[model samples]
Target: MQDKYATLAPALDSPANEGFAITPSDSSDLQQVTRALYVGEGGDLAVEMRDGASLTFKDVPQGSILPLRVRKVLQQTTAAYLVGLC
Candidate 1:
């Protein structure tokens, strides 16, 4: 089946953490959940678990991507990428 990403996926964590600096090294484990980012030319972005349930930039705006510190652990977590509602 073709996995689909939602327009505004559920937020599992925030972006600004006190004692954390998370960064997705691969972004593979999150091949199931859809991320919350505005499609733009700022490079492809994927939602990630910074600490628990929040976002890096809350919303990816309309033409920007989340910073690396506020994303998933690449080969870890269970998030996904999205452009619109499938």
Candidate 2:
């Protein structure tokens, strides 16, 4: 199939062309940094940003799409079934 936007530069708001399941871990980083995260379940989410800053998002709703550039999903995250969009 031909992609009309193939030549366009990808921005944060651009649709994701690739995705991978995310497992929260304290010692491991994701194979690829995410442009966004798909939350299949709701809860507090702790993550390490691409810039190496750590933070937590509280009370994230289920099925929410968070536009974040994260390198790691920390074990402190309570949310489940995370898919990293890249």
Candidate 3:
């Protein structure tokens, strides 16, 4: 039998806790985000996937980590702090 799903490649290096101000674009320069932990510092972060799906995080306190799979970030939104754990 064969696996139904393929495993993603391991990250070349450890994930760094970096701040990013995501903006929507038609550019395909987006990275292949396998997983990410949202670091609550600023306000809540809203995520939009490539499949036209959306997810919003509300009332997340500071230092909270929310794991999610993201294909792209929404445009013209508030700052969403996250630690990319790919």
lDDT of 2 by residue, 1-86 (tens): 99999999998888998999999999999999999999999999999999999999999999999999999999999999999999
Candidate 3 lDDT over 1-86, as tens digits, reads 76443354445353433444334443442466535655546555566654657766665576765556666655533445544445
Writing each residue's lDDT as its tens digit, candidate 1 over 2-85 gives: 435434454435332123223355534333333333234333343455454543333343454333423343333233332321
Root-mean-square deviation (CA) per prediction:
14.6, 0.9, 8.3
Q: lDDT at 49 for candidate 3?
A: 58
**Lowest summed lDDT over 10 consecutive residues: which window, candidate 3?**
21-30
Better of 2 and 3 by TM-score: 2
At residue 39, give the lDDT of candidate 1.
38
User: TM-score for all predictions?
Assistant: 0.22, 0.94, 0.51
lDDT measured at residue 69 in model 1 versus the true structure, 0 to 100: 28
Sorted on lDDT, best first, the list reads 2, 3, 1
**In model 2, where do residues sit more than 4 Å from their true spots?**
none
The candidate scoring highest on TM-score is: 2
How good is model 3 by TM-score?
Answer: 0.51
Name the candidate, 1 or 3, with the larger lDDT value: 3
Q: Candidate 3: where are CA atoms >4 Å away?
A: 1-29, 76-79
- Residue 28's lDDT within candidate 3 is 40
